[model samples]
Target: MTAPSAQTDRFVLDRMPPRDQWPAFRYDLPELRFPDQVNIASRLLDEAVENKGWADRPLLRSPQLTLTYAETRERVDRIAGYLINELKLEPGNRVLLRGGNSIGMALSWLAIVKAGLVAVATMPLLRAAELVQVIDKGQPAAAICDARLLSELELAREKRPGMVRHVVHFGSPDDPQDLGALAARQPPLFRACPTAADDIALLAFTSGTTGMPKAVVHTHRDVLAACECWPRHVLKAAPDDVVTGSPPLAFTFGLGGLLVFPMWAGASVYYPDAPYNPETMVRQMREHGVTTCYTAPTFYRQMAPHAKAIGIPTLRHCVSAGEALPDATRQLWKEATGIEMLDGIGATEMFHIFISSAGAEVKRGAIGKVVPGYQAKVVDDEGREVPRGTIGKLAVIGPTGCRYMEDQRQAKYVHEGWNHPGDAFLQDEEDYFHYQARDDDMIITAGYNVGGPEVEDCLLAHPAVAECGVVGKPDEERGMIIKAVVVLKAGQTGDPAMVKALQDHVKSHIAPYKYPREIEFVTVLPRTETGKLQRFRLRQHTP
Candidate 1:
């Protein structure tokens, strides 16, 4: 890789992993190779129009509007021009983006990359304190946010004055100073910045389930390489497929599934007018003729009933990730729609999904195989490779891997050449990887090891259970006792009879000892903004 130009700002570059510590990146795959200097937005968006020869094809669609490839390209260029000429943002400056999933957010992300600035995208649900940490850590030069979501960001800015130099708001028609008004004053054409492929493109903050969020640095080549690996091999999306999902664009999952994958396949994506519940998601699929969808396992479980009632005939592909996909949820979705859910595991550090399976390759209970450009293994606690069928830590190396910015945890996350993702798994003789539990999520009761997710899966298979979380509770007799926290479906009572029935159900489904020794019912389970269950919260309530 070539060095960044002298004029390029080096805030993000200076914080990256040292050259010797970086994972071994493979560009031998034809699709993985790129020029020394590449602008991903230009290659994926602008060149897409020139190569496809039909600029009128729809690229982005929402209930409010549908933009053609030509239209999206023009708006992206105008936004790039606005950032460069009006805001005076220099190449390599970090610009924070805060919004729900919307075309404006998508345009800002593409424009940021096109203009050679590092994009720092945040979840809309983050409060002032969380935003302050991101602001202080990234030290972004400017922020472009949705007007509806500006209050928290403003509060954060007050606490850290001068950290972010400029603030621009969009999505409020009444505000004349919004990004839309500013971009309208700029020309619709802007030249793409000549950035080195190694230059950092974005700083993705972890979900902070354990503690303070760590910023994961990814580059232009990293982003494009992610696009090449999974979508090309597993998804195999066509040019006419219409995609929609519930994951926020700020998430790497949503970034790849909703934006990058579709653009690379020359397909279109539909952003819902509002955040979707299961009912709304089903309705949208029926009304918009959605072909592909992306969401989590819990969401698939919730939507199974609604999808059965509302019949999504146009839907073909469904993706489940962000957490382990329980066997019961996968079976329920298949029974309802006859379409198997493609399961994958990815991290912000890797940019997108690296292990996934789709269509006929979908296995019964495994999370598919390693993606084409990646290699994975199960390693013991001491970093030695373990034999098949032995549960151990999952270590991976590929075109993209963990590169935490200026964090000591970087040393812990990567060792030798493998990225340890902190999850335990077992590989079968057929080379299929099965997720067991997070290294921290395992439970030991009466000297027998149990995976909490295995119990949670059994609970989800029960008729009256809507959601559940399992953890180990302190006990004087047994080293630890398996405890379950559950949420009942609507119109179901959380009485002792229901708890007894759930316990009986689990005992019958799996080993009797793995059944929850105690059960508690709640109205809702604590989860992160991206819909990942916070098992730590459940552990706090355990006695």
Candidate 2:
């Protein structure tokens, strides 16, 4: 049963899918328990100083600025005061946040939740059209944006005039509507809203696609539950640990790893002034003494050579998500930096990493066990539990589950009270789950079913291959034929002989029938800004 909500506006509450459509939530873990009325912003920020005794400890840090726990709470309270007193936004109102990963962006997000408003954070790379879709769906009453990324939001507002009434810009000194200026006008202290645990906290939309994204609703309880499960069991972050990552604050992966996880541990996060490349990311980690790093597999792959050349001695925990982690890339990163990569798979639907292993519990090819607070199993098409060693769909349920905002796809995601994330997997006798491919990406040729990731992992082990994506190509002889799109290493040629050698390499490593029958060379692969490979786009490039 859901705790009674304190929000009077009821805008988001009315749009929530019917209670029957919601996935069953479990709070079996002792840490998952929470008070009936809980405010995550207060629980995370204010409690850091009030309860955790981290008043003077550094909370948010960058080369340009550093804010202690008390100072961060002060700024958060001031921004919350501005939103409530100046903008007149009521509880349950949604505020759209736009910016790259920075201290100001973080402050705005925390302030929105603290003010009892739902935060709708958008990716930094979103254009006018994408922003329009977000605006149409979320119907935000106001927006607080980074001044540099304001042009796209301005264009979006032009198309949907009066949709977002109040707009404030941050990161600009000269602008008349600067958020910092307006916020400075408000008092430095404001009492956090007393929100119910079930009240909506944020609306995280799925990215990396052209279609209108689905809005995933997360509550204060959901956010706090995720922090208890993943960070407590898998990450085990320390208070003094300095965290850094490449994911924008918009993505749920970033929200958890970069912001919420750090606050949960009373740790500090370093946000770079500018965007990060392999060179710059390595430099930041080495110079700033970053202890924990969160990024995708592709970024880790690109940074391996750089980390090998320049050491990051303080680095301990490295998290890989946003996409599958190829064992070859994992081996390369481990060889370069002695720290083993903590690979996990999470979705915007589930909020954060639910399947991961760290330290000595790391397995070579599995995505570890179900998180402490969660239960998972591999089930066949009919949603029946598949036998161990059999491949099927992965279903999960815990304190957090799929709760799309009035989307019909809720039925498709939640089946029999479990949240299916659309990934195909197999469970070993020891209960480790091995990822096959995305259910849509599994390739079947001549009655032979092959997992593309297994074949891609095999091809990635070769010396010539730098990056590759495998998919099925429609064929006349067979239903489909395996095709490999590859990006070769520098100084390597992608000629006919090279393709044959790669084919032979895969055939030797795995089943010959699973080898990619056709090979195409490309300079780069299409990927989401968060580093997920767009295999659907790769499959679109047919002969």
Candidate 3:
């Protein structure tokens, strides 16, 4: 057994069955029973074709263009027809897609599914290093990319001869090489290719538990399950609502929130080429009447100070993820927009959020509960369950688990029949799971272990900080001390007083002992392509 002191703060959950409480935060939908064997695109299109059965209902609305389900499906069908009839593609063939979100991207993605080809969508912001890693791993037969980001492909093409064929901008195809023109010329209405439950649908790469990025292979069931379960359980978005948010499409969070979640429900979605700047994102939200928003806790933190400027009058549901949702940010959103930012935590391996609380169960600081279909527990090193409130590795078991096709990272995460991917979570007696931090993100100093995120959360409550990261830096005296690298709000200067003030603020908000020992104020902190803070990079700058 773990130490009794470790169990002291453990929250006890009721052992017996509790009273059944229907989700008050959700809009009732006909309860769904998912089928065993399925293909994602086939299901998405078929549902809109059948149940939603709405003709020409809007399917996508980007900053560049708006497309209806009829328009999108027809074009995707043609593209699928092109891939099958002309490209000679078959189900399960890997196709690399390199670009940001666009109508063409949306169409190509659908086309891959419609043709039964596996999609390897990458973030546009990924550099050649990450690209080469993915290309070498997947060995895709074909690629589609935007014209602007073509140079990286040029670098990749030198190495990945397998990715010889490339798809560029849609226009009058002068002749043989224009995939866009060919797709446009083909007729819509193609039959769905039969696929098995275990067939690979998407291959997403997220940071490995060992620090290297690992490619996670997800099946038709895993990818589609989140799309279906999310809108049903979390967003409650209908065909009438316009959904939009900021996350690179490569990130599963963005894929689900910005594209799949809305489209799966036959609702419209929008994406802009530029960064999700508060001025532009808020403008689009109001102009398009975007009903649902999903983004990082940091994004919300930045938007909070300019809440009214960002136009929150008609906003309905806003969610925070990619980082913990600080109480200050959540309370600020409610004060500014009359809505709380629902907090959720998920990883790329899980595809999307498997743990989230519906709006009604909103706890100020705790991330909600395990999603209904997913089972979670806090466990010790030996896999035995831990008592409530004791922080331990969070393990998940569900319809989805790791199928790390041809990668050693699989064994590193999926252990002893449990998908325990190095996350730390604390569960309460009420079943609410509080995310502690990533396992490696914990810092030990003078025999005390502190979570990086817990300290970062405290500093973010300061008005001077816009975004922050906490990392353990080498200290000969105390072994290791918490250091905060902070980015200030626009027009704010990093003065001596501000650094001291931030430290003082954290001391007051959290355990005084956990205050950042050193403060380095910078204009920006390094982040992953999908906007997650890269603490590894922050540690390099520590003096």
Candidate 4:
């Protein structure tokens, strides 16, 4: 149950899936309970300054500016005033956000939610073709975009002329129509909207690493509840910690790891001025005095070789998600920096990490026990619990779960009080959850089930292999054959002897029958902007 809504525009609220189809939520932790009327942006910023006494603590730090808690609240309030008083936007009007992980982008996102508007954030690399899909689905009333990335968004807006009525650009100091300039004109004190805890706060679209994208709906309570679970139990973040990461704010992994979790712990996030590469990321961590880091396994793999050379003395915690953390990558990073990587598995539907272990609790090959506030089990195809050590779909229920907006896939994601995250997993006697491959990505060769990650992990350990992706290619005789598309190291050549050496390398390490039957060498592997390997693209393009 929830308090009365304060939103005037019910476009998103009206389209929410029926209540009966929703996953059951739990509030075992004291912090998970919240008042019926609450706004996340206000609860995170204003309460921190006014009640928690973080007024003078540094909050948002970037190359351009560093703002204390009180100063950030003032900027957020002015932006809220511009959204409400100048733009004439009513509560619950969706505001589309398009930008990189910059100070301007963070302020815009906080202001949108503070004013009781639904924030729809898109990836910075998406072109007009992909942007149109989000615009048609979210049907936003206004947009706040980075001035540098405005061209593609403008092209998308031309296709759907009436979808978004207002637009403002940020990150442009000289433009009078920029968001910061307009925000400066408004009073620095604006009342926060009284949104219900259950009111929709953001619409997060899937990264489409697999296929079609789905819009995930999350509430104010969902955001705060997530902050209570993972960070409190596993992360144990301190107020003085400095956080830095490569995941973009558009991805939910970044949104929580980089922004929401840091704010919850009263930590500061330092955004680098330049886009991160392996060299740049390591150098930035050393220069910025970062204590906590977050990125995917792919980035960690690439950065492992450079970590010790550049030196990051202040770094203590390294969190990996967005994709599976292969044992090879974890070992590589540990050998380089001597810091045990914290591996967790989370989905956009679940909002953030539900299963993770930090410090000495981390297991060798399993994502640790469920966070204090969540429950997870591996279940067979028919929705019954499977025995330990048996691979099945991963079902989870927590403070947050899947709530898709007007998508038929909602039923497939949520059923019988549990949200199935579409991944295959197995539980051990110790209750550690071991990740298999995505249910659809599992390869069947000669009637034997082979997880692609197991083979890819073996290949990653080889000296000549820089990167690789494994998929099942259709075959007339054997049903499907395991195909490996590999990217060799700079000095390595893909000759006949080299292929035989790699094939022999896999046979010696893993099962001989599970080796890749077909191998193709290329300069680079196809990957999503978030550093996830695009297996679907490999299935399409691999010959």
Candidate 5:
């Protein structure tokens, strides 16, 4: 690793764990080798312009317009120049990005990276309280946000005055200080920062499903390495492929799938004008000729029916990874599109999917084999490797691993050079990993242990069920009882008979003990913005 330069901003670097505490970062693959001083934005964007074939290829496309690789690079350079010359942002200063999936948001992210600043991209739906948590932790010097989503950030700014010195908005004609206005005044040429490969590139905050969000720091090498692994081996997208997805750019999953992977493959990404629901996603894919997609299982389940009705002919690869991909959902998607959904497991800590399978390598119910650049194992609580087929915590080490920003929880997440991602898994004889549950999500009912996802999968197979969440409810008799909170399908009645039918369905499908002893029907189940079921919320509802 290269030593930090005097010009490099040390805010994030100063907060990172000492060298001895970091998980072992392996660069065994020849492609994973990075230069001492590297700027990922230059590799992903500027280098493409120098290539004959890739220079003119479309990089980012929306309903309104398309940006070629050269065009996108120019815009990135201008924005980066504006940040440095106009806003006086120093290298390593954090820049908060707030926006939905759009060309502007993508440009802002690349600019931040090019400027050698840490990008703290927040979800569009995040409120003032949530924004404050990130602001307090990252202490960003400036924010480049979508104008429409400025209210909450403004509120947060009011609460944390002096933390953020400058604010530039996009998608706002009324605002005189919009990013576009500032960029236009600057020259469209700026030298990429000469930062080290280990220099922090971005601060990816976790969804905070269980507690306050933790900022997962990723280095320039980490981001580049992630692109090399999954996109190179698993996804295998071509230059002509048009990619689209529902995950917001704020999420690492979205950032990789939508922007990074496409640029890495010399492929193009299509961002929709409006947010995509199931129907809209199908329509947009068909209209724009999208060949690759990345979204959650719930969205896939919803889109499967529409895909069957009006086929998405151009779509060849559909990647699912925010939560575990239920077998039922996978089968349904395959039946609908005649294409198997590529399932993978990744965390904010790891940057992108480290375990996944594409094409013929995909197993029926497994989250595929570990990617080429990574290693994983099922380990017991004591960090010893567990026997195959034994449920234990999943530990992983790769080119990109967890580095929390100034958080004590880092010790808990990284132990003895391995990242424990809090999920339990069992590896089979074939070396394929099967997700059981989050260590805390496993339910112990009447002395029988059950994975909540297994019960939810069984319930999802039933025609009457739309969505469901299972949790262990406190009980006086048994230590705990398996309780289910279900959302019925449209026009389906949620009565005693329906509940009994679901219970009976689960009993018939799997072990009888796994069936929910108590079932409560509701209009909807609580979920994160990324479509992960908030099982903790369901547990709170349970007695």
Candidate 6:
């Protein structure tokens, strides 16, 4: 699964030498499979226990609780034994985990993996409809949910019975089994089940960006494969550094950044309950001497305005994903904190970062060069490679690539040994890729392939438009009309004249055809917790 050389276009890996590995750039990469075969939990935890001798080193930090590595591993083993012996959780049994940010939540996640059960961590904010939808799709045999959120799962059970027969309460003991008591009954040590490379370890569902949601089956290798790329080419995370963040552990971005990445290097992560607020997060960063931080671009934008107030700067590196990191946000952060935030684009399918700048390759606005092992090129609808600097659908190929849970989307993603997620981006002459909007989000009007994000950037430039969503609407003459759904600043009114002014403003800033044919103002647009604008939702209801 090696990428082709930079000069030649042919693909080669273990069987053949990379055609462009000119001047002795070849390094042998060991092909180690993921959890099923290698048992990452045993490899990381047991190895740390033996060599490092986990002696009360702090692993989790919150306003209320502080857990050490030895304590964490003990709890993880207890829960693993309890899950396997008591619950009879054999390999491949799907288990849904729904809970708020807590240390218990983190331990439970690892325990499931240790027990060889497939873990599906859903965002805590999801309600009955979303819960029932995933449960119906995944048919999880059991669910571990906080008592506070138990009512939602109950409602979901009403809609889809027999989906989850067993429920483990996180907040209290309601099922004759508490996480602590259940673990205490089992042995202190647990060994991983003999598994294979392709064993499904996680079934991460999408945010339903395009349409109905579907499960994404990630192998044990995919989980460890992500950690493989982190230090190899992407963020060079050291073992002694501490990782902290604001994303829920449920999100793949958060799981990799805060939990897995740190564990891969035998480092610790700080998890606080009330630290989601920017003010509290900064306080945690200073108090904990947090070294690595991964969060969304919008969170950075919110923090940049008030960065000066939060002092005590010991942070080393920061990463941004989930949404486009606006240059305005990046520059403001650097000016305020003296730390440059690296931006990258990753989806639910790929698990970890694929396109990011690392080391000294910061380009401010441009997403960094394709990873050394990954091959990314701009291609047309037919999957033919396009010339550099031309905006087209961005396709990727690498050792650690995508494998969709189903067939239809998998066929669409895998083309000519490449994976295309329908994102439109342009590659610079220097091999860096700049993200355009999604191909489905492109607003075509009057025979123009106007990218929605390009128009949204223009609208974002306007001071009045606090947030905006651009989409193409049905039209009588021009095939499709450009429509902009806008959220103005507080106390601002959306009048007909204001709409006209916004249209005129867009026309002035960019091409005339990019002007919004329709503008509707609202207080707020739909957004995922990661701050990614839900354009499909906006299009469904508004347009």
C-alpha TM-scores of all predictions = 0.98, 0.98, 0.89, 0.98, 0.98, 0.88
Per-residue lDDT of candidate 2, residues 1-543 (tens digit) = 256776777888889888888999999988999998999999999899899899999989888799999999999999999999999999999999999899999999999999899999999999999999999999999999999998999999999999999999899867666888888889988898889999999999997643458999999999999999989999888898999998889999999999999999999999987756898899989999999999988889899999999999999999999888999999999999988999898999999988888888888999888889999999999999999999899999999999999899999999979999999999999888899999888888999888888988998999999899999999999999999999999999999999999999998988889988899999999988788888888877875
Q: What overall lDDT goes with each candidate model?
A: 0.89, 0.91, 0.72, 0.91, 0.90, 0.74
lDDT of 4 by residue, 1-543 (tens): 459998889998999889988999988778898999999998999989989999999989987789998999999999999999988999989999998899898999999999999999999999999999999999999999999999999999999998889989999888888888889999988788999999889999999888889999999999999999898889998898999998889888999988989999999999988565898889888988899999989888889888978889999999999888889999999999999999998989999999999889999988789889999999988999999999899999989999999999999998898999989898999999988899889888898888899999999999999899999999888888989999998999998888888889899999998899889998888888788888999999754
Minimal lDDT window, size 10, model 5: 1-10
Off by over 4 Å in 1: none
Residue 473 lDDT (model 2):
96
Q: Write the per-residue lDDT of candidate 1 for residues 453-494, one digit (tens) a residue.
A: 899998998888889999899999998999999999899998
Candidate 4's TM-score reads 0.98
| Candidate 4 stretches greater than 4 Å from native | none
Q: Put down candidate 6 lDDT per residue, 331-401, tens digits, no spaces.
A: 66788888878888877777767789954787855878876556678998898889988989988765555
Cα distance off (Å), candidate 2, residue 520: 1.2
**What's the count of clashing pairs in each model shown?**
0, 0, 4, 0, 0, 1
Higher-TM-score candidate among 2 and 3?
A: 2
Ranking by lDDT: 2, 4, 5, 1, 6, 3
Q: List the residue pairs that clash in candidate 3.
A: 10-388, 11-388, 11-389, 13-429
C-alpha RMSD of each candidate structure in angstroms: 1.4, 1.2, 9.2, 1.1, 1.3, 6.8
Model 3: residues >4 Å from true position, as ranges?
A: 1-33, 166-178, 207-211, 490-496
Instruction: Give the lDDT of residue 182 in candidate 6.
Output: 65
Error (Å) of candidate 3 at residue 455 is 1.7
Error of 1 at 320 (Å): 0.5
